[model samples]
Target: MALSVVMPLDISGESAKYPALFEKMGVDFTARRCTTPEEVVVLARDADAIITEGSQCPIPREVIENLNRCRIIAGTQIGYDTFDILAAAERGILVTNVPGYCVEEVSDHAMALILACARQVVALNEAAKRGEWGFGPHSSHIREVIRARMDALGGKTLGILGFGAIGRSLAPKARAFRMRVLASDPFVDAPVGQEAGVEMVDWPTLLRESDFISIHAALTPETRHVFDENAFASLKPTCCLVNT
Candidate 1:
Protein backbone atom coordinates (compact mmCIF):
# COMPACT_ATOMS: atom_id res chain seq x y z
CA MET A 1 0.00 0.00 0.00
CA ALA A 2 1.19 3.51 -0.81
CA LEU A 3 1.91 5.96 2.01
CA SER A 4 -0.94 8.49 2.17
CA VAL A 5 -0.46 12.20 2.91
CA VAL A 6 -3.53 14.40 3.23
CA MET A 7 -3.76 18.20 3.43
CA PRO A 8 -6.91 19.20 5.36
CA LEU A 9 -6.48 22.74 3.98
CA ASP A 10 -6.60 24.17 0.46
CA ILE A 11 -2.99 24.03 -0.71
CA SER A 12 -3.75 22.98 -4.28
CA GLY A 13 -2.16 26.18 -5.58
CA GLU A 14 1.02 25.34 -3.68
CA SER A 15 0.98 21.65 -4.73
CA ALA A 16 3.59 22.17 -7.43
CA LYS A 17 6.04 23.27 -4.75
CA TYR A 18 6.06 19.79 -3.19
CA PRO A 19 4.37 17.26 -5.52
CA ALA A 20 7.59 16.26 -7.32
CA LEU A 21 9.30 15.80 -3.96
CA PHE A 22 6.44 13.65 -2.65
CA GLU A 23 6.46 11.66 -5.88
CA LYS A 24 10.19 11.15 -5.52
CA MET A 25 9.57 9.77 -2.03
CA GLY A 26 6.90 7.44 -3.45
CA VAL A 27 4.10 8.89 -1.30
CA ASP A 28 0.46 9.43 -2.27
CA PHE A 29 -0.66 13.04 -1.74
CA THR A 30 -4.15 14.56 -1.50
CA ALA A 31 -5.20 18.18 -0.97
CA ARG A 32 -8.63 19.04 0.37
CA ARG A 33 -9.77 22.23 2.08
CA CYS A 34 -11.63 21.54 5.30
CA THR A 35 -13.54 24.32 7.06
CA THR A 36 -14.93 22.45 10.05
CA PRO A 37 -13.68 19.95 12.61
CA GLU A 38 -16.10 17.31 11.25
CA GLU A 39 -14.70 17.86 7.76
CA VAL A 40 -11.13 17.44 9.04
CA VAL A 41 -12.00 14.25 10.94
CA VAL A 42 -13.68 12.73 7.88
CA LEU A 43 -10.99 13.73 5.36
CA ALA A 44 -8.09 12.70 7.60
CA ARG A 45 -9.61 9.44 8.77
CA ASP A 46 -7.26 7.27 6.75
CA ALA A 47 -4.39 9.67 6.16
CA ASP A 48 -0.92 8.58 7.18
CA ALA A 49 0.03 12.23 7.59
CA ILE A 50 -1.91 15.49 7.75
CA ILE A 51 -0.58 18.82 6.45
CA THR A 52 -2.26 21.94 7.75
CA GLU A 53 -2.04 25.69 7.23
CA GLY A 54 -2.66 25.91 11.01
CA SER A 55 -3.60 29.60 11.15
CA GLN A 56 -6.86 29.40 9.21
CA CYS A 57 -8.16 26.22 10.82
CA PRO A 58 -7.68 24.60 14.19
CA ILE A 59 -7.14 20.87 14.73
CA PRO A 60 -9.01 20.51 18.01
CA ARG A 61 -8.86 17.63 20.49
CA GLU A 62 -12.14 16.30 19.16
CA VAL A 63 -10.72 16.07 15.64
CA ILE A 64 -7.56 14.40 16.89
CA GLU A 65 -9.58 11.85 18.87
CA ASN A 66 -11.45 10.83 15.73
CA LEU A 67 -8.46 10.44 13.39
CA ASN A 68 -8.13 6.76 12.56
CA ARG A 69 -4.65 6.42 11.07
CA CYS A 70 -2.92 9.80 11.05
CA ARG A 71 0.62 9.36 12.39
CA ILE A 72 1.77 12.96 12.08
CA ILE A 73 0.36 16.51 11.92
CA ALA A 74 2.59 19.06 10.19
CA GLY A 75 2.02 22.79 10.36
CA THR A 76 3.29 25.28 7.76
CA GLN A 77 3.97 28.06 10.28
CA ILE A 78 6.23 28.40 13.30
CA GLY A 79 3.40 28.69 15.86
CA TYR A 80 1.22 25.58 16.35
CA ASP A 81 -1.16 26.94 19.00
CA THR A 82 -4.09 26.13 16.74
CA PHE A 83 -3.38 22.40 17.11
CA ASP A 84 -3.97 20.40 20.25
CA ILE A 85 -0.51 18.91 20.79
CA LEU A 86 -1.43 17.24 24.10
CA ALA A 87 -4.32 15.40 22.51
CA ALA A 88 -2.25 14.46 19.46
CA ALA A 89 0.60 13.16 21.62
CA GLU A 90 -1.81 11.10 23.70
CA ARG A 91 -2.89 9.43 20.46
CA GLY A 92 0.77 8.80 19.48
CA ILE A 93 0.62 11.41 16.72
CA LEU A 94 3.78 13.41 16.05
CA VAL A 95 3.34 17.19 15.77
CA THR A 96 5.78 19.31 13.75
CA ASN A 97 6.13 22.94 12.65
CA VAL A 98 8.35 24.95 10.28
CA PRO A 99 10.52 27.37 12.27
CA GLY A 100 13.05 29.91 10.92
CA TYR A 101 11.32 29.77 7.55
CA CYS A 102 10.79 33.54 7.48
CA VAL A 103 13.30 34.62 10.12
CA GLU A 104 14.93 37.37 8.05
CA GLU A 105 11.65 38.74 6.71
CA VAL A 106 10.00 38.83 10.12
CA SER A 107 13.06 40.28 11.83
CA ASP A 108 13.22 43.02 9.22
CA HIS A 109 9.56 43.76 9.70
CA ALA A 110 10.04 44.10 13.45
CA MET A 111 12.88 46.54 12.91
CA ALA A 112 10.75 48.58 10.51
CA LEU A 113 8.01 48.88 13.10
CA ILE A 114 10.47 49.90 15.78
CA LEU A 115 11.98 52.57 13.51
CA ALA A 116 8.58 53.84 12.50
CA CYS A 117 7.55 54.27 16.11
CA ALA A 118 10.86 55.75 17.22
CA ARG A 119 10.85 58.35 14.43
CA GLN A 120 7.11 59.11 14.62
CA VAL A 121 7.01 58.37 10.89
CA VAL A 122 3.23 58.04 10.54
CA ALA A 123 2.41 61.17 12.55
CA LEU A 124 5.02 63.27 10.78
CA ASN A 125 3.87 62.09 7.38
CA GLU A 126 0.29 63.00 8.21
CA ALA A 127 1.38 66.41 9.50
CA ALA A 128 3.23 67.05 6.25
CA LYS A 129 0.18 66.09 4.18
CA ARG A 130 -1.90 68.54 6.27
CA GLY A 131 0.41 71.42 5.17
CA GLU A 132 1.81 71.74 8.69
CA TRP A 133 5.43 72.14 7.61
CA GLY A 134 7.88 72.58 10.50
CA PHE A 135 8.92 75.99 9.11
CA GLY A 136 5.67 77.72 10.20
CA PRO A 137 5.20 79.08 13.78
CA HIS A 138 2.24 76.78 14.55
CA SER A 139 4.08 73.92 12.86
CA SER A 140 7.06 74.61 15.19
CA HIS A 141 4.81 73.64 18.13
CA ILE A 142 3.80 70.47 16.28
CA ARG A 143 7.46 69.74 15.64
CA GLU A 144 8.25 70.17 19.35
CA VAL A 145 5.38 67.88 20.33
CA ILE A 146 6.47 65.21 17.85
CA ARG A 147 10.11 65.63 18.79
CA ALA A 148 9.23 65.32 22.47
CA ARG A 149 7.67 61.94 21.80
CA MET A 150 10.42 60.67 19.47
CA ASP A 151 13.79 59.36 20.53
CA ALA A 152 16.87 58.16 18.67
CA LEU A 153 17.62 54.43 18.57
CA GLY A 154 21.23 54.99 19.66
CA GLY A 155 21.96 54.62 23.38
CA LYS A 156 18.55 53.02 23.91
CA THR A 157 17.89 49.55 25.29
CA LEU A 158 15.91 46.96 23.29
CA GLY A 159 14.33 44.04 25.12
CA ILE A 160 13.45 40.84 23.30
CA LEU A 161 11.09 38.28 24.83
CA GLY A 162 11.92 34.77 23.63
CA PHE A 163 15.39 34.63 22.17
CA GLY A 164 14.47 32.27 19.36
CA ALA A 165 15.57 32.54 15.71
CA ILE A 166 13.64 35.72 14.96
CA GLY A 167 14.72 37.34 18.20
CA ARG A 168 18.35 36.39 17.59
CA SER A 169 18.13 37.80 14.06
CA LEU A 170 16.66 41.03 15.46
CA ALA A 171 19.36 41.45 18.14
CA PRO A 172 22.19 42.16 15.67
CA LYS A 173 19.98 44.57 13.75
CA ALA A 174 19.21 46.47 16.95
CA ARG A 175 22.92 46.52 17.79
CA ALA A 176 23.66 47.97 14.36
CA PHE A 177 21.59 50.93 15.46
CA ARG A 178 23.90 51.21 18.52
CA MET A 179 21.16 50.05 20.91
CA ARG A 180 21.84 47.83 23.90
CA VAL A 181 20.03 44.52 23.51
CA LEU A 182 18.57 42.49 26.37
CA ALA A 183 16.87 39.11 25.93
CA SER A 184 14.76 36.94 28.21
CA ASP A 185 14.04 33.27 27.52
CA PRO A 186 13.98 30.70 30.30
CA PHE A 187 14.34 27.91 27.75
CA VAL A 188 17.63 29.36 26.41
CA ASP A 189 20.96 29.41 28.18
CA ALA A 190 22.77 32.65 29.07
CA PRO A 191 25.63 31.98 26.64
CA VAL A 192 23.24 32.11 23.71
CA GLY A 193 22.51 35.76 24.44
CA GLN A 194 26.16 36.57 25.24
CA GLU A 195 27.29 35.07 21.93
CA ALA A 196 24.77 37.23 20.09
CA GLY A 197 26.12 40.36 21.85
CA VAL A 198 23.00 40.61 24.00
CA GLU A 199 22.64 40.60 27.74
CA MET A 200 20.56 37.76 29.14
CA VAL A 201 18.25 39.31 31.71
CA ASP A 202 15.21 38.29 33.70
CA TRP A 203 11.76 39.28 32.43
CA PRO A 204 11.27 42.00 35.03
CA THR A 205 14.66 43.59 34.30
CA LEU A 206 14.00 43.46 30.57
CA LEU A 207 10.66 45.13 31.07
CA ARG A 208 11.81 47.90 33.43
CA GLU A 209 15.11 48.76 31.74
CA SER A 210 14.26 48.53 28.06
CA ASP A 211 13.38 51.60 26.02
CA PHE A 212 11.62 49.28 23.58
CA ILE A 213 10.35 45.70 23.84
CA SER A 214 9.87 43.26 20.99
CA ILE A 215 7.82 40.10 21.57
CA HIS A 216 8.79 36.99 19.60
CA ALA A 217 7.72 34.27 21.99
CA ALA A 218 5.51 31.35 20.99
CA LEU A 219 1.97 31.20 22.33
CA THR A 220 1.79 28.57 25.08
CA PRO A 221 0.26 28.14 28.52
CA GLU A 222 3.25 29.75 30.21
CA THR A 223 3.58 32.51 27.63
CA ARG A 224 -0.04 33.32 26.87
CA HIS A 225 -0.96 36.68 28.47
CA VAL A 226 2.62 36.99 29.77
CA PHE A 227 2.31 40.64 28.84
CA ASP A 228 -0.73 41.70 30.75
CA GLU A 229 -1.73 44.84 32.68
CA ASN A 230 1.02 44.24 35.24
CA ALA A 231 3.56 43.67 32.48
CA PHE A 232 2.59 46.91 30.76
CA ALA A 233 2.84 48.77 34.05
CA SER A 234 6.45 47.58 34.39
CA LEU A 235 7.52 49.19 31.15
CA LYS A 236 9.10 52.67 31.05
CA PRO A 237 6.50 55.31 30.25
CA THR A 238 8.47 56.16 27.08
CA CYS A 239 8.93 52.54 26.04
CA CYS A 240 7.66 51.34 22.67
CA LEU A 241 6.55 47.75 22.11
CA VAL A 242 6.50 45.91 18.83
CA ASN A 243 4.83 42.48 18.60
CA THR A 244 5.67 40.12 15.73
Candidate 2:
Protein backbone atom coordinates (compact mmCIF):
# COMPACT_ATOMS: atom_id res chain seq x y z
CA MET A 1 0.00 0.00 0.00
CA ALA A 2 2.85 2.37 -0.81
CA LEU A 3 1.93 5.83 -2.10
CA SER A 4 3.24 6.50 -5.58
CA VAL A 5 3.75 10.20 -6.41
CA VAL A 6 4.29 11.49 -9.92
CA MET A 7 5.62 14.96 -10.78
CA PRO A 8 5.21 16.97 -13.98
CA LEU A 9 8.40 18.95 -13.20
CA ASP A 10 11.61 18.40 -11.28
CA ILE A 11 11.13 18.75 -7.54
CA SER A 12 13.86 20.82 -5.83
CA GLY A 13 14.61 18.40 -3.02
CA GLU A 14 15.08 14.82 -4.21
CA SER A 15 18.35 13.16 -3.30
CA ALA A 16 17.90 14.16 0.33
CA LYS A 17 14.20 13.24 0.72
CA TYR A 18 13.84 10.16 -1.46
CA PRO A 19 14.80 6.71 -0.03
CA ALA A 20 14.60 8.49 3.34
CA LEU A 21 11.01 9.29 4.34
CA PHE A 22 9.56 7.63 1.25
CA GLU A 23 11.61 4.52 1.81
CA LYS A 24 10.61 4.49 5.47
CA MET A 25 6.89 4.97 4.70
CA GLY A 26 6.91 2.30 1.99
CA VAL A 27 6.01 5.14 -0.42
CA ASP A 28 8.08 4.99 -3.59
CA PHE A 29 7.25 8.40 -5.12
CA THR A 30 9.23 8.58 -8.31
CA ALA A 31 9.34 12.11 -9.74
CA ARG A 32 9.48 12.18 -13.51
CA ARG A 33 8.90 14.81 -16.19
CA CYS A 34 5.51 14.16 -17.73
CA THR A 35 5.77 13.71 -21.50
CA THR A 36 2.53 12.47 -23.06
CA PRO A 37 -1.18 11.87 -22.59
CA GLU A 38 -0.59 8.15 -22.27
CA GLU A 39 2.16 8.67 -19.68
CA VAL A 40 0.01 11.17 -17.75
CA VAL A 41 -3.02 8.86 -17.78
CA VAL A 42 -1.04 5.83 -16.74
CA LEU A 43 0.79 7.55 -13.89
CA ALA A 44 -2.18 9.58 -12.70
CA ARG A 45 -4.53 6.63 -12.81
CA ASP A 46 -2.10 4.51 -10.85
CA ALA A 47 -0.82 7.13 -8.45
CA ASP A 48 -2.29 7.53 -4.99
CA ALA A 49 -0.75 10.98 -4.92
CA ILE A 50 0.21 13.30 -7.79
CA ILE A 51 2.38 16.43 -7.99
CA THR A 52 2.04 18.52 -11.12
CA GLU A 53 3.83 21.54 -12.62
CA GLY A 54 2.01 24.08 -14.78
CA SER A 55 -0.77 23.80 -17.35
CA GLN A 56 1.29 21.88 -19.81
CA CYS A 57 0.14 18.41 -18.76
CA PRO A 58 -3.54 18.66 -18.01
CA ILE A 59 -4.91 15.88 -15.81
CA PRO A 60 -7.95 15.35 -18.02
CA ARG A 61 -11.56 14.40 -17.23
CA GLU A 62 -10.99 10.88 -18.47
CA VAL A 63 -8.05 10.49 -16.13
CA ILE A 64 -10.15 11.68 -13.22
CA GLU A 65 -13.14 9.56 -14.20
CA ASN A 66 -11.13 6.40 -14.69
CA LEU A 67 -8.60 6.79 -11.93
CA ASN A 68 -9.28 4.26 -9.19
CA ARG A 69 -6.56 5.02 -6.65
CA CYS A 70 -5.66 8.72 -6.82
CA ARG A 71 -6.80 10.53 -3.69
CA ILE A 72 -4.43 13.46 -3.18
CA ILE A 73 -2.68 15.83 -5.57
CA ALA A 74 -0.14 18.50 -4.59
CA GLY A 75 0.91 20.90 -7.28
CA THR A 76 4.52 22.07 -7.11
CA GLN A 77 3.68 25.76 -7.22
CA ILE A 78 1.03 28.41 -6.70
CA GLY A 79 -1.00 27.85 -9.89
CA TYR A 80 -3.05 24.65 -10.04
CA ASP A 81 -5.53 25.69 -12.69
CA THR A 82 -4.05 22.92 -14.80
CA PHE A 83 -5.46 20.24 -12.49
CA ASP A 84 -9.24 19.70 -12.38
CA ILE A 85 -9.91 20.48 -8.75
CA LEU A 86 -13.70 20.37 -9.14
CA ALA A 87 -13.49 16.87 -10.49
CA ALA A 88 -11.03 15.94 -7.76
CA ALA A 89 -13.45 17.23 -5.14
CA GLU A 90 -16.36 15.41 -6.72
CA ARG A 91 -14.35 12.23 -6.28
CA GLY A 92 -13.48 13.23 -2.71
CA ILE A 93 -9.89 13.95 -3.70
CA LEU A 94 -7.77 16.52 -1.90
CA VAL A 95 -5.90 18.81 -4.28
CA THR A 96 -3.27 21.19 -2.89
CA ASN A 97 -0.53 23.61 -4.00
CA VAL A 98 2.35 25.58 -2.49
CA PRO A 99 0.90 29.11 -2.45
CA GLY A 100 3.72 31.09 -0.86
CA TYR A 101 6.67 28.87 -1.80
CA CYS A 102 9.80 31.01 -2.11
CA VAL A 103 7.89 34.23 -1.51
CA GLU A 104 11.03 36.29 -0.98
CA GLU A 105 12.72 34.76 -4.03
CA VAL A 106 9.66 35.58 -6.15
CA SER A 107 9.41 39.09 -4.72
CA ASP A 108 13.06 39.60 -5.53
CA HIS A 109 12.47 38.29 -9.06
CA ALA A 110 9.54 40.67 -9.66
CA MET A 111 11.52 43.63 -8.37
CA ALA A 112 14.51 42.66 -10.50
CA LEU A 113 12.34 42.57 -13.61
CA ILE A 114 10.68 45.85 -12.70
CA LEU A 115 13.96 47.56 -11.95
CA ALA A 116 15.63 46.11 -15.03
CA CYS A 117 12.89 47.52 -17.21
CA ALA A 118 12.92 50.79 -15.29
CA ARG A 119 16.71 51.22 -15.42
CA GLN A 120 17.23 49.91 -18.95
CA VAL A 121 19.78 47.51 -17.49
CA VAL A 122 20.36 45.71 -20.74
CA ALA A 123 20.81 48.79 -22.94
CA LEU A 124 23.14 50.47 -20.45
CA ASN A 125 25.12 47.31 -19.84
CA GLU A 126 25.61 46.94 -23.57
CA ALA A 127 26.65 50.56 -23.87
CA ALA A 128 29.25 50.18 -21.15
CA LYS A 129 30.57 47.00 -22.73
CA ARG A 130 31.27 48.87 -25.98
CA GLY A 131 33.31 51.60 -24.22
CA GLU A 132 30.28 53.88 -24.35
CA TRP A 133 28.71 55.52 -21.27
CA GLY A 134 25.61 57.73 -20.80
CA PHE A 135 25.23 56.75 -24.44
CA GLY A 136 22.24 57.64 -26.54
CA PRO A 137 20.03 55.20 -28.41
CA HIS A 138 21.53 53.51 -31.43
CA SER A 139 18.27 53.31 -33.35
CA SER A 140 14.69 54.61 -33.31
CA HIS A 141 13.52 51.25 -31.98
CA ILE A 142 15.61 51.86 -28.87
CA ARG A 143 15.20 55.65 -28.62
CA GLU A 144 12.86 55.30 -25.65
CA VAL A 145 15.09 52.80 -23.79
CA ILE A 146 16.97 55.44 -21.85
CA ARG A 147 13.78 57.21 -20.83
CA ALA A 148 12.73 54.06 -18.99
CA ARG A 149 15.75 54.55 -16.70
CA MET A 150 14.84 58.16 -15.87
CA ASP A 151 11.28 57.27 -14.84
CA ALA A 152 10.52 57.22 -11.13
CA LEU A 153 8.72 54.45 -9.27
CA GLY A 154 7.81 57.08 -6.63
CA GLY A 155 4.69 59.24 -7.01
CA LYS A 156 3.33 56.43 -9.18
CA THR A 157 0.81 53.69 -8.55
CA LEU A 158 1.74 49.99 -8.55
CA GLY A 159 -1.22 47.84 -9.59
CA ILE A 160 -1.06 44.15 -8.73
CA LEU A 161 -3.57 41.93 -10.48
CA GLY A 162 -3.80 39.24 -7.80
CA PHE A 163 -3.14 39.83 -4.10
CA GLY A 164 -1.74 36.42 -3.29
CA ALA A 165 1.60 35.80 -1.59
CA ILE A 166 3.65 37.52 -4.28
CA GLY A 167 1.37 40.52 -4.25
CA ARG A 168 1.49 40.73 -0.47
CA SER A 169 5.29 40.46 -0.57
CA LEU A 170 5.57 43.21 -3.20
CA ALA A 171 3.60 45.78 -1.19
CA PRO A 172 6.38 46.56 1.29
CA LYS A 173 8.89 46.89 -1.53
CA ALA A 174 6.61 49.31 -3.34
CA ARG A 175 6.04 51.18 -0.07
CA ALA A 176 9.79 51.43 0.48
CA PHE A 177 10.03 53.15 -2.89
CA ARG A 178 7.30 55.65 -1.84
CA MET A 179 4.90 54.31 -4.45
CA ARG A 180 1.23 53.80 -3.72
CA VAL A 181 0.01 50.21 -4.04
CA LEU A 182 -3.33 49.28 -5.57
CA ALA A 183 -4.31 45.65 -6.08
CA SER A 184 -7.28 43.67 -7.37
CA ASP A 185 -8.05 40.16 -6.21
CA PRO A 186 -11.70 39.16 -6.06
CA PHE A 187 -10.75 36.30 -3.75
CA VAL A 188 -8.83 38.51 -1.29
CA ASP A 189 -10.73 41.03 0.84
CA ALA A 190 -9.78 44.70 0.56
CA PRO A 191 -8.71 44.79 4.21
CA VAL A 192 -6.18 42.03 3.61
CA GLY A 193 -4.31 44.12 1.07
CA GLN A 194 -4.93 47.34 3.00
CA GLU A 195 -3.25 45.89 6.05
CA ALA A 196 -0.12 45.64 3.92
CA GLY A 197 -0.51 49.34 2.96
CA VAL A 198 -2.11 48.52 -0.38
CA GLU A 199 -5.44 49.96 -1.39
CA MET A 200 -7.53 47.43 -3.19
CA VAL A 201 -8.82 49.06 -6.36
CA ASP A 202 -11.10 47.90 -9.12
CA TRP A 203 -9.73 46.80 -12.47
CA PRO A 204 -10.52 50.03 -14.25
CA THR A 205 -8.87 52.23 -11.65
CA LEU A 206 -5.85 49.96 -11.54
CA LEU A 207 -5.57 50.20 -15.29
CA ARG A 208 -6.03 53.93 -15.53
CA GLU A 209 -3.89 55.18 -12.65
CA SER A 210 -1.09 52.64 -12.39
CA ASP A 211 2.32 53.48 -13.79
CA PHE A 212 3.36 49.85 -13.41
CA ILE A 213 1.03 46.84 -13.76
CA SER A 214 2.24 43.54 -12.34
CA ILE A 215 0.42 40.31 -13.19
CA HIS A 216 0.29 37.73 -10.43
CA ALA A 217 -2.93 36.01 -11.39
CA ALA A 218 -3.27 32.25 -11.63
CA LEU A 219 -3.90 31.21 -15.22
CA THR A 220 -7.32 29.73 -15.81
CA PRO A 221 -9.89 29.58 -18.57
CA GLU A 222 -11.01 33.03 -17.46
CA THR A 223 -7.53 34.44 -16.85
CA ARG A 224 -5.64 32.75 -19.65
CA HIS A 225 -4.56 35.30 -22.26
CA VAL A 226 -6.17 37.89 -19.99
CA PHE A 227 -3.37 40.27 -20.89
CA ASP A 228 -4.11 40.10 -24.59
CA GLU A 229 -4.52 42.88 -27.17
CA ASN A 230 -7.49 44.69 -25.65
CA ALA A 231 -5.94 44.83 -22.19
CA PHE A 232 -2.74 46.21 -23.66
CA ALA A 233 -4.79 48.72 -25.63
CA SER A 234 -6.38 49.83 -22.36
CA LEU A 235 -3.07 50.38 -20.61
CA LYS A 236 -1.32 53.75 -20.69
CA PRO A 237 1.22 53.60 -23.50
CA THR A 238 4.00 54.61 -21.14
CA CYS A 239 3.01 52.11 -18.49
CA CYS A 240 5.55 49.37 -17.75
CA LEU A 241 4.23 45.81 -17.44
CA VAL A 242 5.98 43.08 -15.44
CA ASN A 243 4.90 39.48 -15.06
CA THR A 244 5.97 36.66 -12.71
Query: How many residue pairs clash in each candidate at the backbone level?
Result: 0, 0
Task: Judge candidate 1 at residue 241 and give its lDDT.
Answer: 93
Task: Put down candidate 2 lDDT per residue, 42-114, tens digits, no spaces.
Answer: 6667778776765656675666777788888776677788778888899988888888778888888887877
List residue ranges in candidate 2 displaced over 4 A.
Answer: 8-16, 55-57, 135-149
How many Å off is the CA of 13 in candidate 1?
6.9
Kindly report which residue pairs in candidate 1 clash with one another.
Answer: none
* TM-score on alpha carbons, each prediction: 0.89, 0.85
Off by over 4 Å in 1: 12-16, 19-26, 137-141
Q: Pick the candidate with the highest lDDT.
A: 1
TM-score of 2: 0.85
lDDT of 2: 0.76
**Model 1, range 105-127, lDDT digits (tens) per residue?**
99999999999999998888888
TM value for model 1: 0.89
